[model samples]
Target: MKVTESPSYSTPEVSKVMDQSRRFIATASDRPEDIVEKADTEIIGLALQMLSDGTADQVIIVTNDIPLGEAAESLIPKYGFTADQVTWLTGGELAPELKEDFVSEFD
Candidate 1:
């Protein structure tokens, strides 16, 4: 599992969210899957790079935005990636299982 974020998260509010996530997963390392600017436009490319570089055979994109998920789906075939190779989570469906104490520290 890897985490990816836009460089724009350096701003105050987004940085707060990033910090909260880090603090919540205190034992985890602070490294990201990749740090790139404009994730909205670059994530698909990054995914391809990961695949081509053999860094990941499968990728699960966890996001809150519907369109971002859709865009990823549309680009999958164009990049010779298969449906099973990519997974999408547009909601926090996986969040419920996280430790409550860690989750409550955010939002």
Candidate 2:
């Protein structure tokens, strides 16, 4: 699952989490674990990192999967991401739009 929001809604906690995630992604090793299951933390870190990196001028992610949805919601508060910084796209299945879940702002 993914969300799309403006920076205005970003919270301190979210910013901090995003920071950690970004750092992980920017410097990840080329090893298989770095890009795969061995690095769940690294994946989350990379996802958030991409969001702040501006990989796309505009982006949105849509998903209704319980694991992803719940985790995303929980992480928002824990991370302090604002409502706007976070978004939910209601749907029955994952699709191309959801691919933007990894939006990044890095050059």
Candidate 3:
């Protein structure tokens, strides 16, 4: 699990419960010097590491962030992952053009 430190989100609390299912929680730092502010960056990094290290056969990303999902999809193929091995879940299944509706649900 990837957790972002935010005033609005209780990441630590969530992480404790999620830890039972997954071993580690990739926590993000609140550094003003950082380029990226989202947890997606850490999530993507962990996913890539899992693939390259041969720890996971496939990586499934469950994010509402469109750019992060698209960026992850582009990089997964470089690690020898096929289309079937890389999956994105944004709440519901929808066509790429209709994904905007899916994203709106989070808003």
Which candidate leads in lDDT? Answer: 1
Better of 1 and 3 by lDDT: 1
lDDT of 1: 0.52
lDDT of 2 by residue, 2-65 (tens): 4433343244544565444334433443333234232333334334445556553222334443
Instruction: Give stretches of model 1 more than 4 Å off.
Output: 3-37, 97-107
Between which residue pairs do clashes occur in model 3? none
Question: Candidate 2 overall Cα lDDT vs. reference?
Answer: 0.41
The local distance difference test score of each candidate is 0.52, 0.41, 0.51
lDDT string for model 3 (12-106, tens) is 32232223112221222222323343465556555655555566778788766655566567655655668776777764553465565563421
Name the candidate, 1 or 2, with the larger TM-score value.
1
State every prediction's TM-score relative to the real structure.
Answer: 0.53, 0.35, 0.51
Query: Which ten contiguous residues of candidate 3 have the minimum total lDDT?
Result: 20-29
Rank list by TM-score: 1, 3, 2
> Which RMSD does model 1 reach against the true structure?
12.3
Q: Ten residues in a row with the worst lDDT in model 1?
A: 22-31
| Winner by TM-score | 1
lDDT of model 2, residue 54? 52
Clashes of each: 0, 12, 0
